[model samples]
Target: MWPRMDGIRVLELGTPGELRTELTELTLSGAKTATAGLPALDYDAEREAVEHVGERLVLVDDSGMRAGEVEVTRVELVPFGEVGWEFARAEGEGYTSVGHWRESHRRYWEGQGCEVGDDTTIVCLWFRLV
Candidate 1:
């Protein structure tokens, strides 16, 4: 049986539909190991909660089902425009360039009612499948 997430804080790793399933499969298959997000909340508190290296983060699917865990290896807080291409590629979102990541993330943040700006901060979480 899959280990229950229970009281552990979970983050949604997949989008809706087939893409969601695909990302989850990649995680389980050990191909995709990193993720990035722009949380619309208190930055300091949120960072304190999630940015610890060696900490375990519970990854969930669109249905909120626990797929597995990842151990945080690195974390970076950088402006939207400052996200490096190397990290963007690590996202495994099929984004061919930093520009692609910027466009996609802008749409996602805007869709969530959050305004995206060049100086807006994003938390980039680098992890390994655990």
Candidate 2:
């Protein structure tokens, strides 16, 4: 979720189809100006605003876990844009390579009764590091 300079929160739910429908519906109820899909996000506008604030941004992922669930994993914030692209390309090659990672992971987890929906949600909550 990328929050614009004007406090517009943009949540990117990386699912197969309209996984963000739930979030978008909630936002429309009162959030206002809420939208789904990355196309609606004006990256240029965000880039310019980020420059004024800072280059670094924090992304929070709270999709799979239930509300108020204890977070056992550590949250790591990665800088986006060129630097982020380079980092992902170098360190996280698997992330860049499109394969059956999700399916494989789902299968592995499903064996243990953990089921990830047909679409995996990659929530990106963009925020300043302060």
Candidate 3:
């Protein structure tokens, strides 16, 4: 299970390293308004529920320090291949296209031992810094 600060769920992006730092910085700067995850690997395996609209969460850094707070605005379950450019751009990771996003995400998930294919279910979450 993920950690909570002050009774709110924590949003820790990626692993504890450079990637996490970069992503957290983007989030804090309001550049990142969305994120994606594998429901099976991230939620079911971890026994956590998918975030709901209007839910408030604590954004945390690599060291588990609270960077800020965010409120969920939207959530959708989309197939990996069906994820679109709008969502990709909302990630604020400089993805040139949906293909680029898919490739990068595929590699990331596969590196973490999660099998990712075109049909893999992806949880697309949109949030705003609060």
lDDT of 1 at 6: 64
**Best of the candidates, TM-score:** 3
Clash pairs, candidate 2, are 1-124, 1-125, 1-126
Alpha-carbon RMSD of each model: 4.1, 13.9, 0.7
- How do the predictions measure up, each by TM-score? 0.80, 0.21, 0.98
The best candidate by lDDT is 3
Higher-TM-score candidate of 1 and 2: 1
Instruction: Mark the regions of model 2 whose C-alpha exceeds 4 Å error after superposition.
Output: 4-54, 64-88, 95-130
Tens digit of per-residue lDDT, candidate 1, span 24-85: 88777876767777756424435535457887768887677677888889988889899989
User: In order, what lDDT does every prediction score?
Assistant: 0.74, 0.29, 0.94
In the range 69-113, model 2's lDDT, one tens digit per residue, is 111121222222112332222222144432343444345445634
What is candidate 1's TM-score against the reference?
0.80
Ranking by lDDT: 3, 1, 2
Worst 10 residues of 1 by lDDT: 41-50
